[model samples]
Each structure stands twice: as C-alpha cells, then as structure tokens.
Target: MLPIRECVEQTSGYIPGEQPRTNDFIKLNTNENPYPPPLEIFEGLQQELTKVRLYPDPVSTQLRKAAAKVFGVSSVNILAGNGSDDILNIAVRTFVNPGETVTFLDLTYSLYETIARVHGASVIKIPTDNRFAINQPIICPKAKLIFIASPNPPVGKHLNRDYLEETCERATGIVLIDEAYADFSDENHLDFLNKYDNVIISRTMSKSYSIAGMRVGFGIASIPIIEQMNKVKDSYNLDRIAQLLGTNAFNFQEYFKVIWQKVRQTRSHLIESLKALDFLVFDSDSNFVFASSQWIPASELYKKLKERKILVRYFENPRIKDYVRISVGTDQEIARLLEVINEIKSGQEFT
Candidate 1:
C-alpha cells in the first residue's frame, strides 16, 4: 500500500454539495446560481473551443486585467484561479509551512480545515458567537494564514466592519477574505486592501455571475503577495476556455445585476415563506437561507425531501444538526418546494 499520510488516511475529507448526475431532482443542495449565465458566456466558449491546441496563459494575464478592471485594482495586484477553491489552496500552500498554525472561524467553510490537515498545519478554530457571529478577540497571532468567508455559507451572515478590521489588525500573517458571495451582500472588504498589506480578497464567478461551470475566480492583494501565490499555481490552471468565458461574462455586469436582483427578491420571498411555514430562518446575506424547524428534525426532512426528488443541504455536523440550508432557486422551484412543505405539514406530502 502507498504510504499515505495519517491525515489523509483518517480524514473523511470535505464533502462538497452533491451533484446528482440526473436532472430529476430540484437541486438546492449546492448554492449554485439557478439561472444560466448570459448567452455570450456559452457563445464565447464555443468560439474558444478551437483554441485548445495552444497552451492557456499560465498567469492568466488577460483574465487578470479584466478582473482588475471589474474590481478597480491594479492588474499587478490580481491573481486568477480555476476557482476560489484553487485560490484557497494556493493561499494555504504559499503562506503556511508545515507545523505552522492556520486559523479560521468555526462553522465556516469546511474546506479550510481539510486543506490545513493536508498540509500538516495546526488549525486554531475560533468558534463563532451564536454560530453566525464572529467570536471576537481572535488571539492567534501565531497563525500563518486566516480564511474568512464574507456572508459565510450554511449561515449566510456577513462579518461586520469592526470584526474584519480587528481581524486584520490582530493577525500577523496573510488575511484572506473569501468574498465568493459578496455580490449578494451589502458588505464588502476589498477596501481593506488600502489599509492592510496583509489582506487578500478572493472572488469567484460561481455565484453572482452564473458561471460556476467555468470555474473562474481571482484574488486581489499587494503585488508581492499576488506574485508569490502566482508562483505556486499549476501551469495553465485557468484553461483557455475558462479564460474566455470568465472574461466575457465579467464584462457584462448589467446582466448579472438583474440576475442578482431577482435572486435577492426570491431570497426575501423564500425567507418570508419559510417563516410562514414555521421554519426558523437565519438572517442571510447570501443567495441561500440557513434554517431549522420545530416540526421535524433536519435529518428527517433531508431524507424525506430526497424521497420527493427535492434536494436541500443538511449537515450531519453536531452544532448545526437541527438546520438545513436551502439555496434560493427560481421562483417556480421555490413555489413548488413551499407547496411540498405545506402538504408535508398537512400529513399528505412526500411523494
């Protein structure tokens, strides 16, 4: 047998949102954008299909420049990735040496923990206050890097300005702010770059741009930091097709603006509907809602919903075992979900 590291052998690994191969189920498990991206994204992918013979720009120069324009940062300060997952992986590998400590919030992105374990880095998890609020006074000055997701998943709460400011002020290492869902939220920390050289903000086209399939993301930081991470990235991480589609989709911000507006509207309606049905919905700043119910255990609901061919996320993690996270989908899909819930409550639901 291969000499796998103990961490690799023992760990369950990060379980990503399920991608059922069939289209029979209503997929609210992953927080994927329900709508397709602008027609140009697909058209450009088609146009770029013939260019696969040539190597993609290893540094993603054109994508970086376009992202810099969209983000209002210098191209020198930007680094593109296959996805924010790649960006996160780069941050961990570039910043933290084995035996160093990496810190992030508890009940946060689980991928951070998995990455830390892989690198043999000590992880200090600061448990969130009330499970969604930052557990303040993060005192881990020994940390080599910290990852915080704005509008954190499963809970979808944004970190306040003071918490973000204090986290940057306290940490001695790279402070990575994952803004994967920032387009749906009112809070943004990109401006923190002006105040702290240690700060890096990572953004993705997955959520708001409706381009999750393209696997495009980027990070903005000081030129030195960007350059260092760029060095560790796999050659041609962002393939030519991804580069073309991401650049083209990012250029059309107007279409995504409308898409986000509708998604936000649907989010609001989903919250209201869930509350009306006696579900305890958390205040969310992302495209999904984290909610619990007194009527049934989340595990049971998860199983029953699956039986009905409607999939939402239910974590088996002890802290949030009572809750299920539902991604906001098309209005019609949400309506159907609500109807199913009603029938279930009436003792006549669950197909």
Candidate 2:
C-alpha cells in the first residue's frame, strides 16, 4: 500500500449533521430554509434540462453577473462555486501555503478546522468571548487566513460592522466572512469590501434562497483576490443547471423576499415562544434560535423530540451541550414543536 501524508493520516474530517432520508420527522437539524425556492428556479431548471449533454460554463459567467448585480459589485468581484463549502476550500488553497496557519472561530461551522487540515495547514481555534462574540484582535493578527461566520452557527451571534472593520484593518492575511445567514439579518459587511482588499464575504443559496440541493454559492471580494481564486478553481465548478437556476432566483428578488419574510416571522414567533417557556434563548439574527434549559438535559430533550417525529440539532461540545439549535419552520410546524415541548415539560412524552 502507498503511504499517506502525515496530515492526511491524522485529520478528523468534517461531519455534516445527519440528513435523515425518512419523512417521518419534522427535520430541523440543518439550518435549511423552510420555504421552497421561487417558481422561477424550477422553470429555469426545466428549461435547462435539454442542455445537460453539454458541459456547464467553466467560468459561470451568467451566474456571476447575476450575483454581481444583486450585490452591487462588478462580475470580476464575484466567483461562483459548487457550494460555499467549495469556496471555503478554494480560500484555503488560494491563500494558505502548505504548513501555514488558518484561523476559525472555536465553535463555528466545525468544517473550517477540517478544511484546514485537509489543505495541510495548521488550525487555530480562536475562542469566542463569554457572549459568543468573535474576539477579532486575538484572531486576526496571527493567521494567514481567518474564516468567521457572521451570525455564527450554533450560537447565531453576529459580529458587528465595527468589529469586522477593525479585524480587516489589523489582519495580515485574507478575512473571509461566511454570511450563510446574512439574508436573515439586517447587518451586513458588503460595503467593507470597498475599503479593504483582504475582506471576502461568501454566501450560499442553501439557507435563504432555498436551494441547498442546487449547491450554489458565491464569494464577493476585491477583484484581485477573486481573480486569484478564479485561477485555482476547477473550470466547471458550477454546473449548467445551477447557473441557470441561480440566476433566475437572483432575478426574482421579490419572490425570495416573500419567503424570507415568512422565515423571519416564524423565527420571531419561535424565539418568543421558547422564552415564554422559560428556555434561555440567545439573541439570534439567523433563521434558527439557540435555546437552553436545565429542566431537561439537551440530549434527553432531543431524544424526546425525536420520538415525537421532530428533529433538532444538539451539539455535543460542552459549551453548547445543554442547548439545542432549532431551525424556524412553518408557523404550524413551530406551533406543534411548542406544543410538544410543553407536553414534555408536563412529563408526557409524545412517542
């Protein structure tokens, strides 16, 4: 047998949440949008089906142009990928030489550490403050590339604009902000790109645009930085269907807004309901809420909810062990979840 690299041998890979195949459960483990993609996406994909025999555009020009228009940047400033995960991989490869350092928030998407290891870079986990805020000064100054998920996962806490600006100003290498949930939040650092060449904001269609299955994601950065990534990316990183559908989705902004409004409304309702039940809910700007309680162990609560055909995410990490991250679903789904939680509180398990 051939020998593997030491880094490859020791790496523990990224584990995405369990995506159950059965429809029996009310799935909330992944922070996927509850709404479906706009009708235009389906229509666009249907029209493109005839073209599958041809290879997708290697440059993804049309999708990049659409994204550029939506984000108020030039096409040269945008680069499309199979998914934001692919873009992350590109960033690691583009910026960090082998044996260099890549920094990520201690309890972020969890994939960052794994991605760094795969790229043969040393990983540094920068611990957030007690409130789960990214401590910029401590993280930015040392790393070759820093990946921060604004409105970060699990905790759903966002890094404010001033903090982001400060981090970019002080950082030695690229500062990548994973804005997977930015559509759900009012604060965004898009404008910061005008001032900082090192800043890159990456977004996915999975969360807000309701196209996780489509695997469309794009990165916005200074044109120079984008050009570098473009050089390193696979020519056909995004398929023909994804390009067509993603462009159509971006074109129909109003339709996307309608679904986002619903998700925000459901998110608010879920947060308030959780608080009313005496769960300690974090201030969430994302599509999900982080709620914790001592009344029941989070693992037990997760199991109970599972028995009732409701699934939510429970992290085994000690900092978040007592909490379960629940995605905002339809109003009726949320109502049912609350009902189940209440029943569980009353010692009636709904299995």
Candidate 3:
C-alpha cells in the first residue's frame, strides 16, 4: 500500500464543479465570468516572456501596491497568493495547530472543511437557519480559526452583519472572511478589519476580474497577520505572469465596474425567470442564483440540462438536493437557458 498521511488517507477531497471538455456547451456549472478579460491586460505579455526564465518577485510588491491602491489599504496590509485557495491553506497552516478546531457555516464553501481536514485540524460545521442564515453568534471557544464565506456558495445568501460583528467580538480566534463573491455583493466586512485585530478578508481575481486562469488572490489583514501568513506562503506565490496580469487587472476596475453592473442586471433577470418557471429561487447577492423546482428533482433537471449541453451545479447533499445553482452568464446565454427550461417544463424531451 502507498504510504500517505493519515489525514489525507481518511479524507475524500473536495469535488469541484464540472468543467466540460468541449466548448460546445453553455457552461453555468462553475461560477466563472462569461466575459473575456480586458484587451489591455494582454498587450504587454509578449514583452514579459523573457522574465519568465527568472524567478518572480518574491514579495509581489508591485501587485500588492496596485491591489492596495484599489482596495484603499496600504501595501503593508496586502499579501498576494497563487489564488485564494492558497491563502486559505496558508491561514489554516499559520494559525491552527494539528488538533485545533476550525469552524465555518454549514453548506457554505465545502472547501473550508476540506482544507482543515487535510491539515489535521478538527472541523465544526455550524448549522444555518432554514433560509440559510445563522441567527446565533458563531463562536467556538476552542477554535483557532473560523472561515466565513460571505455571500456563501451553493446558495448566494449573505451572512448577517450583526451576527458576524458579534462573532468577532466574542470569539477568541482569527475570523477569515472568504470574500470571493464580494465583488458581486452590495456590502462586505472590510470594516471589521479596522475594528478587530484578528479579522482577515481573502479576495480572488477569479470571479470579478475575469482572471481565473491567472490564479491571483490576495489576503487583506493587519500587518502582523499578513506577516505570519507570508511566512507560510510559497517563496514566489504569485508568478511573473500572474503578478503582471493582476496588477493590470486592478488598474482597469472602471472597465470591470460596467461588467459588474451587467452581471447584476443579468442576475436579477435570472431570479425572475426562475421564479416565472415556478422554481423556488433565493434572493442572490452573488453572481449566481440558487433555485429548486417542485415539478422535477434537481438531479433530473441537471441531467436534462446537460443532455442539452447546458450545465449548472447540483449538489447531492440532502439538505439542498432539490436545488441547482446556476451561474449568471451573458444575456444571450441566459436566454437560451430559460428557453430550454421552458421546454422542459412543457414536458418536451430532447434526444
């Protein structure tokens, strides 16, 4: 038998959303931006090809500076990573001991539990209310780390701000807000950083900036927290290409703002369309909607959509088994999805 760490051997790793092999499908499974990145970001890449032979900037100074400028924080407060997953791994490693508790909301980002389990830390999943909101304080006295995904996945419900602030006040550990979807939300917990020393907000360029291919993410926290996380990070966490693209991506926020607006508009349309089809759709603050239909099983709906080459996410977990999470695509793509859904509702079967 192969020798592996007990934690790894015992764990069933996270199952990510589907990525179809062909480009012939309308993909709404993974919550990726449907739009292409700004053309300006690619203009200087050819000139940067020579620098790839050398090691990237160890500290990612310029990238951090650019991100800091956009986020309205000093460079000292920012720590860049290969992606927010890298940041989450680093945070779990830096703050938690082998058996220390790491807790997060149930049905949030599944990756949180996976990361903690892989690191040999104890994990606790707190149950949310029926609407996917947690009404009580999220406090674990024995915990060393707490991960909260704002506008959480599977269902794009935002965590209650009051409960979160109360959690920060009462908990004796680090509270890391995984804000990958914050760009699509109306509010965020950035203000918590000023009020609390143990708060960390992790952001990614994948969702809003349309740079998932670049694998760029940032950790925004106090200088002390940033310094510790930096120790656990790879020597060159952000490669030259990522740093260059990420820096340029931050500079083009005005251009992306228009795209964000478009996404919000599409998201509204998606919710209404799903409701019109009698799907029980949640009010989404993120760029996707969580919906379920009484007329059909979500798994069956998923298969039907896939048969037509239109994909969306369906979780097997019993609590949300009836629901499918659909990423907001461009107007035409969403229209096509609605059309197919209507056909399915009318009992039309596709071969």
* TM-score ranking, best first: 3, 1, 2
> What is the overall TM-score of model 1 with all chains considered together?
0.96
* TM-score for candidate 3: 0.97
Show where candidate 1 strays beyond 4 Å. 1-4, 348-351
* Tens digits of lDDT, candidate 3, 235-299: 98888899999999888988998998899999999999899899999998888999999788899
Candidate 2 Cα misplacement greater than 4 A, ranges: 1-4, 348-351
Assess the local accuracy of residue 95 in candidate 2 as a C-alpha lDDT between 0 and 100.
95
Question: Residue 340, candidate 2: how far off, in angstroms?
Answer: 0.9
lDDT of 1 at 255: 89
List, residue by residue over 135-247, the lDDT tens digit for candidate 1.
56565789999888888866988876787889899889999999988998777898999999999999999888887888999988999998899889898899898888888
Least lDDT summed over 10 consecutive residues: which range in candidate 2?
Answer: 1-10
lDDT of 1: 0.87
Question: 1-351 in candidate 2: lDDT tens per residue?
Answer: 112377777888777777888887788888888878756567766667888999988988888899988999999999899989999999999999877889887778888988888778877888888777765554446589999898898778787667777878888999999999989878788998999999999999988888888899988999889989998998789888888888888988888888888888888889888988879998888999999965888999999999999999988888889899999888888999999999998784334
Candidate with maximal lDDT: 3
